[model samples]
Target: MDDSELQAIRKARMAELQKQQGGASGGAQAGGSAGNASNDQQQSVEDLLIRLVRSGQIQKKVSEQELISLLEQLSQQESKANKTKIVDNSTICELTFPTSVLKVKMNRKRLLVILEEQIYIYSLKNMELLHVLPVRSNPRGVCGVCQSPLHPFLAYPGNNPGEVIIFNTDSLEPVTVISAHKSDLAIVSFNPPAGKGSKDDRLLLATASEKGTLIRVFDAVTAQRLYEFRRGSMPTTIFSINFEPTTNKYLIVSSATETVHMFKLGEPAKARLRPSNSETEAPAASANKYFTSVLKMLEPQRDYTCLRIPTNGNTGDTSSGNGKTKNLGSANHINREFKSAAAFCKDMVVVVTSEGYLYQFKFRSPEFKDGELVQQYSLKSM
Candidate 1:
């Protein structure tokens, strides 16, 4: 070969070596972030390093067995920053992103991170990046995932307003796209998995819009409409919407108003449906009879149970025996960004407010008329 050609080959070889070193260094930094990685994270790191070597992104001078031994040493090494070597079991691993995190949701097998325009799904076991899903410009981080391990599904806003994509995380495919509302979506939620014997159990999804008067539920797999619920006649911001985690029979809607509404689902509500009594059956029977009439209905279904959070008490001036602060302030003095969320835990209704108060109410009777506040906890103290 001519002297000029030899020089060119040497330069090319030097560039290739530099590229490989850069790739290896990046992988090492990712591994170092998981200082106290769980066994799963360590295994994932080993798998990644092996793949890099096999793909020529990492040099093959070192055998795979030697690389694995080095990984073991790194995993066992204590962080120099913590001389005491104290381990925090609370956090399993850490994930970094370029953009700010708008929302995060997790299930048994998956962890979802929602950013401004993309959603990232990671495996819960090993914290491996499973998918990067492109979504509409969702500044509010509107997204939901089914908690059921057997049938995992994710829902997010699609390209168009009011459109939602139902994605099957296990199959790594889009199941269906639903035109939930005409306006932009304010909330997207999925009912808890049925955990039934049959794997084909229907996955139900709920959605609300910027005009948060109406809430709709759909069969995610089939794109079939299941239920339509009315929050109120007036338009207000919907704060949070969640299904009863256990039974999936009751749906709770919280909004800007002080009142929280709970509605009974009709069809496809069979997951762990609590045994019906006279009081419960009365409402369902009346709803069925009313809808069966020959006359068409103008409004959607009304709330089955309504719980109004008191906004008129003393504004943090007084303290109860348990030293918990009283009502934050009058309705007019409430924070403009105040948000409220409600969930069902066994028979009690748990309500949490952004003002740092949590109230647990239990129904006085089967009628479920504004249950008495059985317990109160100051979230700020915690």
Candidate 2:
């Protein structure tokens, strides 16, 4: 067909498509007048392009392929600009402490700031110091605070290595003092109410010693031991420990040894293999031994300095290594160590590394095999 005939056919086809779209969006047009206006504007733009082509004002007839390519280029440029954008974080108000601030915990009502040997509790609205409580000299900055609406409490490592002193946030009085471990306390934290089953009413406390060989859980109110899980014989720093928020069925422990340990809680003794079972079935149970097997150890694609456990379902890979057949365990291929991590959803986690690279991992099981890495962000320049 000649140019005029081809242009006429194309114009007719475009008009037909626009009519179909308008009919399909009639319900939306009724619900939103702005949407109808937008559609009208888009149709006008298309008509303008056809008119320009007919008038010979535009020398070139831009094909659909060329338009698509231009759009893709513009999208890529916009994405690049977004990725390189810098964020500014300037100081709003400053609160001076007698010593360096170790950690700060806040809720809607109060702000608890931890110093070298004291905790200053201030009103969130007024910033007035309501109470100042002295704690053991914490040089390593080992302390944790939680102020959940269901169960609120403050915890710190005691002067003695094994002791953990619990205090009431409202009364500023001692709730209970318990000997948690033989070695120095590394960290102490109160697990928020895991919103699952009948355990929603109970708050659990988790503690790790300075040696990092063992992690113990206790009933926060009764001060009764619930579960004890061993990390390893070797002394390592327990970077962070988090309980699954929904079921409390598992606990994730991240350590300096470049490992993440997942432990199944509330399992029967038989489920957790005994020494006798391991001795009798050495070859069969070797892969699932008591201490080593109970701890489902996971090494991330990169060394993770911190991690978060999902609450509702099993959401990590169970494969052996980074989904590669060759050079599976090679040290040269692993990613950089992660500095911190938090749960983004039931199946995804957001991780930040020491070098300021952020990664999101989505998996299907606790073993975290065959997982998908969604996006990686760098904030080093900012």
Candidate 3:
């Protein structure tokens, strides 16, 4: 009886030890699998961050301490392949100028850099000095250049308050002089042709004055005012004004005031038709003014520092037609002012803020009740 009982207890004890050892090994393998998964995720994020930095999409300087902290976090995961090392071997190519650069614009194959009293044109291919154009006391570097193939010219505020001088970029010669306003000129722009095959005969020129009260459009070929609209009675700075591409059916205006205005262009008249009976027709003096009318005035839910509308003929209506505001959960709270904005796609806009945050706003047309927040990216985190 004693020997059989002792052998049975020994067999059961041996099975218990084997089962416990197997369970411990299984737990260790599961923990290792988890670590590998984390390492893989960290590696993916590192690669994307580095690619954006090299492409100049993410522009920020990371502190040494912050970079070291990131590296330590990556190394904590048990994978040698995921241990990322931050490198600062970026080489910068700089173009030296005698004076401080005020504005830089690229047109076709030329690089135009505006300086205090002169505008320097450089070849884009090799950065060779092409020409140096002199100007009269341009302290603010207030100038605009047109890149349209139909009517390509460079314009800047003239010596007089109400003038603008247009210059041909190729010939380096003055094309024409325009007496645009009674007050100083603020900005000048030539309408961009709708398409590559479009004609330039109907292209128009837009100008804003320092008073910021009047915005006028003139025929590029005839140099005659086509229409004039009043912005506001109180003088303010005009941030930007753009005409819709191709059709010229709409105009977008932004000013110092925290509002953006869209105006619908009226149909052009070739000739004023006379009534069959002169008595039935209204007198010329009593006719209604043929100015562009404001279609919509938008004040963004979050105040923007800069705003822009796309003129590439791709922007169309973005309304859902259901009259509902799309709810985008607040993952990234925008606490800073917007610095600039541009059209990203047919119904999307990309806005950059002063705090180095990039926001993508979808459903962003005058037709929409509210712009839908699609995505938020922290550029500073890079």
Candidate 4:
């Protein structure tokens, strides 16, 4: 179209929008919004302060002390809110399977599985059957399978001929298709730290591929890529990206190498994105450090065990040693830790090993200081 024609089209659209704003209180398809835009409320005081700093609105000489004070007050408020945050390790439900190699899908209501390319949705209320949907592809290299934390979509990151298909739970259909950057898939884990407190944040799915370690964060609702977190020296494998239980950050991904990594979903604790100074530099800003020595290691004797059972009690000699089955034997039967899935579900971590055994345990962290994952829990016998 010509310039005059384009201008006329824009004018007509603007007039229509004005008419809608003047008359309507709520549009049928507009989610939480009206045409008038009166609901676009003022920003919070803390948010305003951030905007001022970000937009360079805060004058350089308008008393640095005063701006510092305002920022400190905002920090205090945020800390108070985060202090009340509870660690959600509550056991929701469990799913039993005959075969050890099974995929899992879960929400507040039920657990779904894809075994032998047949989808089985299980009810969480009674642990009964729901329905089954048959998959077309031959189940070959399917490793990581779980529902997205943000939406009602299921993801399986594996050797699907270089592309991973995202399926929906309610309809049992392929909703959106995503892939590794020009290669076969490896491991995929949803970033758990997003969408806190009923917020609709896009689900961040990190995928490993044969090419390298690629991070693909996507909108769970639309199934579109948002940001990509890239790393140096290519990860050993995609399965290397593991997550840890933390309110601060969602992922604790590591390679086969000695170093482990931590990532944040929001504004980092001590980082700000600087304006681009060079073309060669990356766009997004990040604050990550390397683990530097013997301090990187955990105390093997005291930690790494699921739980410490009290073998020697106050009155051990009085009780009969034969009748009461010893707890120490069960605890020490396996010196090695469970080689389960890098990611875990509620109250239970599914660990897999070279030997065929699916072990379940409550992954609890009594503490996390510096960089150690001091997890302790009781083992569940099948």
lDDT of each: 0.60, 0.49, 0.48, 0.37
lDDT of 3 by residue, 1-382 (tens): 3545644643454354334322111100000000011122344455544555466663333222222222222221123231111122331124445565555555665656666666776555554555676656665566776767656577876556767666666665555556678987766766655655544347677788879777777665555556666665677666556565545544555554433444545533323323234455556533532221121111111111222222121223222222221222222324422223222223443333333444444533574433344445665566
Q: Of the candidates shown, which would achieve the greatest lDDT relative to the real structure?
A: 1
Name the runs in model 1 displaced over 4 angstroms: 1-92, 195-201, 267-298, 312-330, 333-335, 363-370, 380-382
Q: How well does candidate 4 match the true structure in TM-score terms?
A: 0.41
Give the 10-residue window scoring lowest on summed lDDT in candidate 2.
27-36
* lDDT by residue (tens digit), candidate 4, 1-382: 4546644643454354334322212111111111110001212333443444455543333233233322221121111010000112332333333333233335545455545444555444554455554433423324343444435655654224445556555554455555445665545555454334545344556565655455555544344444445433444443344444334133434333222333434432122334345666543431221222222221111111221222212112111111132233332324543222233333333332212222222444343222222222221221
Model 4 residue 339 distance off true place after TM-score fit, in angstroms? 6.2
- How many residue pairs clash (N, CA or C atoms closer than 3 angstroms) in each of the candidate models, in the order given? 0, 5, 0, 4
Name the candidate, 2 or 4, with the larger TM-score value: 2
Candidate 2 TM-score to native: 0.56
**Global Cα lDDT for candidate 1:** 0.60
Ranking under TM-score, best-scoring first?
A: 1, 2, 3, 4
lDDT of 2 at 122: 59
* Cα lDDT of model 2 by residue, 1-382, tens digit: 4546644643454354333322111100011011001111123333443454355542333332222211221111111010010111322244555465555555446566666676766555554556666666875556556656744577776656777766666655556655688888877766655664644556778888879888887777656566777666788666566665567665666555434555656643334444543346776456545457445321111111222222122234322332121212322213443233232235544333333343445534465432344444443433
Residue 21 error, candidate 1, Å: 31
**Better model by TM-score, 2 or 3?**
2
Question: Each prediction's TM-score against the native?
Answer: 0.63, 0.56, 0.54, 0.41
Ranking by lDDT: 1, 2, 3, 4
